[model samples]
Target: MQEARYTLDDLLTLMQVLRDPQQGCPWDVAQHWDSIVPHTIEEAHEVADAIERRAFDELPGELGDLLFQIVYYAQFGREEGRFDFHDIVHVLTAKMITRHPHVFPDGHLGSRRQGVAAVDVDTSAVGQRWEARKVNERDSRAATSHLDDIPLALPALSRASKLSSRASRAGFDWPDHRGALDKIREELAELEVEIEAGHQENMNAELGDLLFAVVNLARHLEVDPEQALRGTGQRFERRFRHVEDAVRESGHPIEHTDLDTLECHWQEAKRIERGQ
Candidate 1:
């Protein structure tokens, strides 16, 4: 006897059953669009975390959890008479096929460009075509500002990068990374002025502006500001934990460790990380 693998149909059936009004689990029955949004965001972050941490063994499960968020939304759409999972799949497939004209010459899933390897395609042309299509799509949706389509729920650093990128495309940006670096210095000066003034509200506003300027600099350098910050956070965690462990080995609470001792352990952690 062999074990059976569940298929997409089975998953759809499971979702339908879970949302059944009369017989579904109470918690599943109680969930709605708004209630599930937080879980969707969390699942997305977990998937990113798994990838960033290079946990390939856990990637499948993390990806499945992220997929479940889509399924959950599809079920809600079904109950509200708007759409369902198949509708979502069809729209996505059709839209992608339409966008990728170089790949699908006939504007369809079944059509493919023959005798052309993907590497032979001009990436610059492809990017231009993609952006042109996106602009047309935005026009069809009556988008007024380049920034209008960006989601407010995005993490601030990522959003700042996107906002600046959009502005750059609209001819509002610095000519190069040198200009971006100069903007960071200008913002930092303003921040310092606010700090010296001891105005809490102005300081907060200036600090935000300074961080946004840094994000713009990151964009110019072709780096993701959010991912860079997350990497820094991980390094800080490793160094702090090393300090904690050293204090523990000395039979003292980390809270009671002197600043100089903690600094010594932190430096040691950095030295070890550098393979020194």
Candidate 2:
């Protein structure tokens, strides 16, 4: 006999059992939505990390962990009589169907029944339509500003990119990447001035402005600033580990290594990384 494959209903049932007050795992039973928020965020980042690292073998497990976070939230909502997994699924499915007019029957691009091939559809127009639909959704919610729905809990870089995109949609953005690059230079100058003044508070604010300007530049170049920064951090770790290994081979602790010697090791690490 073939082994049975568990369906979404079975997953929901598993979550329900895990959250049962009398017989569930204590940790699972004790978790509320708020308590799981950090884990949810972490699982999301882990999924991203797996993709960034091209760890295809780990992708399924990472994705499952992220899905479990959603399941956990749905279970909490079910307990409170607010919503459930099916409600979440329903809303998501409806939203996708509503968003894809080129593919959906009621969409602007006509329907599959009209014999429109996906390859023949104008993707740029589809993207514009998607954005317009999102704006409509925002309006329906009575959002006071274009940026009103941006999540405050987003990572600073991601949030900055989103905020910039929202403002751009309102015609408040730079005309081009050149303008963004100039703004970055201007911000850097302001930061330099603050640094020279030796005022910690002003320096802090100026530095934040500088970083935000760089994020704007990244946006103009169509780069996800959060992902770019994460990639840079990974590269730094890899290079630093190479330096550490070099130091260990030299029989000296890193702290005792001279700056020039460490710099040499770093250069070597870069050369090696570049296949030089």
Candidate 3:
């Protein structure tokens, strides 16, 4: 007989066994949601990188890793008698169906372009709608009332970027990208003042404001600031490697080269990489 291929249900059942107090794997039983969090974040970034590289085949494996993290959390929940893997899937699936009204609602079928018009109204109006829906959902769940549920545990850059974007969409943003640029300049000036006054906290706050403004400008230009930063990182790595190669070809380590000379090699690297 062929060994049975594991199904999703098998995964769920395995989770239960892992959480079983009497015979469960000690390591798995000892894990908590907080302990597994870093793995989940790492898996998500790996999935993003794989997708960016167009490695479709690698996506399934990376996604499986992420799913395993989720299952691990669900197992922990089950051990605490709070919820199980099934509830996790059911809540997310239902949320997806709810958010995609055009797909889920009866007698509604059209191109995504058709939905864009409704979504492009005044930003505050859209925010109001989302907030209202969120409050209603919270009320149904546990009678919570507030629009400040955004998690504070997200990476600083990501959290700032998202908060800025949401504020922009709420119509409390710069009038245009040019306006955002001015705000960036203003923040830079304030940072200088803080520096002159030796005010570390004020300088830090101003620097953050500058970065937030830049993120806003990136959004207005339809660019992802994080992805833009990553692309520049790749470019810098390639150019720096070229400098290292040139230095090695001349029989010296890169550290031995003078700054100006190495910079020339850096430009050469850029030119060659750009096919210029």
Candidate 4:
């Protein structure tokens, strides 16, 4: 006997069956667009986490979970007579072909053969052209602002970075990284003042300002602030776990550990991590 092989159509069929009124899985059939939003977000984060951890073997499963989220939405849309998976696929395919002028014949950059043969096309120029095309698309939708299309559901750091980038494109940004760094310092000073005044509401606002400034600095430095912060969190967890293990080995309860003792273990953990 041979194992069954399935194609994308098979996957679509499976999704349809799972959402069938009579024979469907109750959980799958009961899910609506809003109900599945959290699962979609979690699946996306899992995909990112797998990539960040360099777990290539786990990537396919994570990607499949993310893809299933799209399929779930597509299924729900079909039931409402809005759109289906094919519509989603078609839009993405068309968008890619339209955006990559250097590769596709219909793109603004002309065909790849003609453009590459004629002269070098810098990646930066390609990126700028892509953004320009997206802006045009937004304009076609009657968008009144450069930030209009940015999703509100994006992580705070990522959204801040994108907002700053859009504003910069609109000529409303700092001239350089130095200016962004200076803004961060100014924001931090304001935060300190708010803290000293013991005004919780003002402190909260000032803290947000400081974080936004830091995100802007990250954008100016061409760093992805979300990824940078995620990496920092992972490192902190690893080091903290090492400190905990050391305390356990020394027969000291973590609750009984003094600040100096914890600091000693933290330094040792850092040294071990650095192979020093």
Candidate 5:
């Protein structure tokens, strides 16, 4: 027989009980905002990983883990007398409706545009309106620049992408991808010079500049730098695993393997990937 399903209230109640002082789980009672941030980020990444891997069966569990992070925050807010999960829902729903005025004509939950198909909506106009609304919201929050409010806690590559995107929106961007491509070559040359000079500090700064240039090129090419890097990492791991397996079959330690042999295996991995 199937068990009864738990609802949102059940989840909220569970969080409250787990966080209750004296009777609650010790770890849950001890947790605070700062300490939970890492767990929240990890859960979010796990959810993303599940989606990217097309693990639909695991998605529900992953999504529940991510939702629990929000519930934890909401529980903290309730304990502090500031807000709760309901408030979060209200703010998110209202903001989304306001931003998508074409769909929500009256900016209310029950309101919808009549007789207009989504395909017939002016997408460019919608985008402009959305940006205008966001700018107004930012200004009301006392933001001093278009770059304001980007979270400092974001991963470096993702943050760099956001910083460059904001700059592009402010008309500081190159005219096309060619300009961004040229920038990569320029940064590469500077990095090479720094390497030759053997100044560790200069090399580090130049390396960062080179990476930022590559990220800009990625933006121009309509690629996400973080996701692209993740994909590359996956490819590297897969091919390296193949190398390890081949080495094990030959009874050779990978440490003692020469570059020529390693390169041969790497090339074979590439060939297999290309179906050659």
Candidate 6:
């Protein structure tokens, strides 16, 4: 039997049906804004993984997963008479055009169909023109006039980095990257002092401050803190799995092994992987 092939449009239609009242899939029908939020974030991470791995074949499937997440919210919104899928698309389309003034501003010579064009800005002076435009957009939307509008739900490190970078753009910044590094060192010292005093709460707070400082340092160095941490996580997973497999092969359970033994196996895994 031949399987039914579905186009992107067909999948979108299927999502609408799955979300319909009185006849929809019970599981899909039961989901709410809060319940599906995690899936949207997960799908976004999957899309990033596909891009990083150059998984061309996997890209379509991953993107479909992301599209379904969008459709789910849209369908639910439609049922409630709040908004429809078209509104979702329309708002983002308008936003993309509006933010890219080099392409969409009056007297602009480029076609809208022509994709985003690159503008070379001095890395040292990143926040002047680009950031001023962002501040204007945010001020138009936000209740407060402050430009640092980093969402509270973003991961602590990411949120801190974004907030610090925005604040720096607004002139509330360390004089230079070296000053930022000095702040990191000071935060670290404060954490160590808290640890020595056995003040768990202070230690935790200082540790957070230290990590936040590290994020600021990453921004200063023109690196993405999220991507850097993700790469480190991937590397650790790879090395740890190698150690686990090697220990299992030697007829020993991981929990039964001492730290010294585990360290030896971990070093071996690193050597093997590095061809050292």
Top-scoring candidate (lDDT): 5
**lDDT, model 1:** 0.91
Which should have the higher lDDT, number 3 or number 4? 4
Q: Say what the RMSD of model 5 is.
A: 1.3
Better of 1 and 3 by lDDT: 1
User: Each candidate: what lDDT?
Assistant: 0.91, 0.91, 0.79, 0.91, 0.93, 0.80
Q: Give all TM-scores, in the order shown.
A: 0.96, 0.93, 0.81, 0.94, 0.96, 0.81
Query: 1-276 in candidate 5: lDDT tens per residue?
Result: 999999999999999999989789999999999999999999999999999999999999999999999999999999999999999999999899999989988879899899989999999999999988998899999999999998998988999999998899899999999999899899999999989989999999999998998889899998999999999999999899989888888899999999899889988998899999
RMSD list, candidates in order? 1.3, 2.1, 4.7, 2.3, 1.3, 3.8
- The superposed Cα distance between candidate 3 and the true structure at residue 47, in angstroms, equals 1.2
Question: Of 2 and 3, which scores higher on TM-score?
Answer: 2
Clashes of each: 0, 1, 0, 0, 0, 0
How far residue 211's Cα lies from its native spot in candidate 2, in Å, is 0.7
Q: Kindly provide the TM-score of model 3 when superposed on the true structure, using C-alpha atoms.
A: 0.81
lDDT per residue for candidate 2 within 1-276, as digits (tens), equals: 999999888988999899888988899999987899999999999998899889999999999999999999999888999998889988988888899867877643334536777788899999999999999999999989989889998999999999999999999988899999998899999989988989999999999998999998998899989889888899999999999999999999999999999999999999999999
Model 1 C-alpha lDDT per residue in residues 1-276, reported as the tens digit of each score = 999999988988898898898878889999989999899889989999999999999999999998888999999999889999999999998888878999999997889899989999999999999988888889989999987789888889988998998899899988899998998899999999989999999999999988999998899899999999999999999888888888999999988888998899999999999999
Record all residue pairs in model 2 with backbone atoms less than 3 Å apart, i.e. clashing: 101-107
Residues 67-102, model 4: lDDT tens digits: 999999999889999999999988898888898867
Model 2 / residue 163 / CA error / Å: 0.2
| Shift of residue 8 alpha carbon in model 5, Å | 0.6
Instruction: For candidate 6, report its TM-score.
Output: 0.81
TM-score attained by model 5 = 0.96
